[model samples]
Target: MASERDYFHLSGPLHLTHVKWDNLYHRKSVAASLVQGVYVQEKDRQEQRKGPNALAFPWWAFFHFQLLHTLVDDVDNSIFGAIYEFKPPPSKCNDTLHKTPRYVIAFRGTIKKPDSISRDIELDLQFIRNGLHQTSRSNIAIEAVRNMVASVGGSNLWLAGHSLGSCMTLLAGKDMAKNGILIESFLFNPPYASAPIERIRSKKLKHRLRIASSVVKAGLAIAMKDKKSSSFDSLSAWIPCLFVNPSDYICSEYVGYFEHRRKMEEIGAGSIEKVATQNSVISLMMSAFGKESEPLHLIPSATLAVNFTPSRNFKEAHGIHQWWKPDLCLQSKLYKY
Candidate 1:
């Protein structure tokens, strides 16, 4: 079974091109102009050969708190400015964890803009599935991969994304599974998933005053369960492996603001509108001018954890947000493949 440490521990660049399979892949590529929605391919190699495994972390994941810069169809906004591309390591990574090469692709596109709802249905499954929508990132992502895989062909593919990306990742998985496409694994963290199940106690990761008994019960379940039974079972031991954070206040307050704003139709109450405005500035500027990427560094914090505050400006907040927690000791967990 794969451990949380396995994924949470990886610190470095990951390519987003992993989601597409080889037979469906045709071009050698990496890197996208965040300012420009266009992606630039790596020099095509004569012999199209990929390493035993690959992981693609797009610009959005690599350049967090950055910008969103992409324009397509009728969708236009400043929510997608800081996207960047990842380069896979050369030479095959031959090892045990490399159990069938895995490729992860993250989409940095945004569907929910403060101004537009044109693509809302396609962006938010809820708009069509449950509520109005989750985010436009998912729809944009699915289309991107369909186009990408149609152009590249090398090997099997595995898709992974967080937040809004989770739905996109699931979409890819379901489609591939149904079509019998090659897929390795999916690495998702605190998906921005929208469903009736998400609102239940079973889905909430928050700690509470009344849940002490529940937490104790959860811990006991972990102790009694056989760790080797199944992946989900072994992992459930850490149920509510809660991250009571000092920084939680900001998130908590922010959630309230949005909930209020949404209910009252008052977008001006919280600093969210201000922040979103600033973010839009960044996105617009970035879309017009691409930026350079610094070395990737993983920062661990509850802001990156599940159900963080400030639902806008960012998609998924967990994953590599805080890659160095003690319980989240990733040193031994990463590099399985």
Candidate 2:
């Protein structure tokens, strides 16, 4: 809280600039990757949409499965960036909102290295799927987030993610809230979107874009100067869509829906339900993976629980051309949601 830079999760501990692991699942080889998969993002892009009545309804934008987190003294004239090639649609945002919420996004269903933060794993498919060893993983990601919130001068926060990332995020949100962190969360295309029974994926459908950069100078001219309305006081999320058909989502991919969809719904809706179902096709496969038995009539709720998107429906639509590509260079606006 001393300085903006001081408000980071781990300043010195950023040591894991490169993470090391192994292909233990296959051959006896080792691997190196960025810690926390901070460099890896799902899908998204940036577009210039300067509104006359308004300009920054959706301050930023991203792809379907990419991950992005930002903190700013001025939510106006925002700097938007992604970690990958594809850029997601910016259709999940509100133009003139009642409150400004903390934005969080994660990829769903897609499994990451055991560290959950490592993203550059190029081993065999089965090898990488083993949930390989991940070093320097954070048990409490919200702590890193909490650090961010503190730096932003806010007590309330918004959380969101897709697939596996979404599940993990909700779990962290629960931990943060239980630990007395005033925060709200959103799950975009998360695998699980149920409370009692697991579902295929979120049903919320929609798109969100990033349009803060180009029009920031003229856009936030009015919104930013508003002393009464502030970002810190109104931290909430409006991403994630429910699986119109939860029965199609997979267990591992649908983790967030199970851990936090209900709670997220209590705070946010619309995108929190359907969009996730639309992003990934794996949910449908997972929906068909398990069998219907007696006591455990549903799928296992232990390791990698949560529904997934079906192949026939929500397939891997990641690309600058597709509506779900995650873009970081910030110069793409040709796709539609």
Candidate 3:
């Protein structure tokens, strides 16, 4: 069993490119003026030659986000995400290479704009309540991935998102799976909609409520299981890679657990589980009471957990740039190549 920590081990050229893609958010010059939706620096090419792996910038992901920026006059309104195509480039170590590309869809964390923040909140609610087609933005992402895949048949897909975007990525995976398209997800600091702890007055009261809620969750899970079983076999095909910071309040209770578990079980497959060490007891108690745990922090067992030590500055810890720090992403084996 590969622990979440094992997934981030950076070694080959492909992993190095991922680190660069993570940092692409900071290079506004590059992100804004993309050559066919992606920019490749000289350094990026140099890193490719250092190892036997070959990779390409996903113009599909970058161009779509760039389109979002154009549609909305405010930069803050941008829903940030980009797709990176990972593969082995032509090299002596890898002479015969298949052209099939593994598409990685990455979403940005929270930004400073008020509208963007509000947009995230809106999308979160829709995701929790109505599922995938609830928001136009999510629809756009799904359609984009679908079209890209259709254009290039037999392409393996991956999803990555941070903060609110994590929610989007997870939902996209669900929808993609429903369409019989399998995808792998990499989520960061995703928040879940949990029952308000303040609502529970005492442990005794909480215990009673837990029993009642268990019935409801079980019923709902069963209903969801039945509903999804007809459509898809196993969510295990959609491998979930989760990253989290223990101290971050935004991800105290990961919500992606129940839904994913049901999906995976539909096909008699198992892999989903929590990866974050922080909020374990809290999440357990919440689950006992049938409340949703943290969002992406604590999900299905199959979830590859990559835990991070948060910064003292709470805001910095949750910021997208903070997670991309070399000390964090570069420490672990990022790709299996």
Of candidate 3, the 10-residue stretch with the lowest lDDT total is 34-43
The candidate with the higher lDDT, 1 or 3, is 3
Task: Report the number of the highest-TM-score candidate.
Answer: 3
Cα-based lDDT at residue 238, candidate 1? 20
- What's the residue-level lDDT of 126 in candidate 3? 56
Q: Write the per-residue lDDT of candidate 1 for residues 99-170, one digit (tens) a residue.
A: 332233543322333343344345543422222223454355555555545645214333443333334444
Residue 277, model 2: Cα distance from true site in angstroms = 24
Model 2 residue runs over 4 Å out of place are: 1-95, 102-135, 153-156, 189-247, 251-337
lDDT of 2 by residue, 1-337 (tens): 0222111232212222221212110000000011112212111112222243222212222112223443111212112111111133455333422233333322233432233213322211212232111212223344556565665533334444433444444444544543445454433333332222333233332111111111232233233332212321121221122221233333222333233333334556423332221211222223334421111011111222112223334342211011121221212111111
Write the residue-wise lDDT of candidate 3 on 201-238 in tens digits. 47566445434444454454443332323333444355
Query: Can you tell me which runs of candidate 1 are displaced by over 4 Å?
Result: 1-74, 77-104, 108-139, 154-156, 185-187, 190-320, 323-337
**Model 3 TM:** 0.53
lDDT of each: 0.29, 0.27, 0.43
State TM-scores per candidate: 0.34, 0.32, 0.53
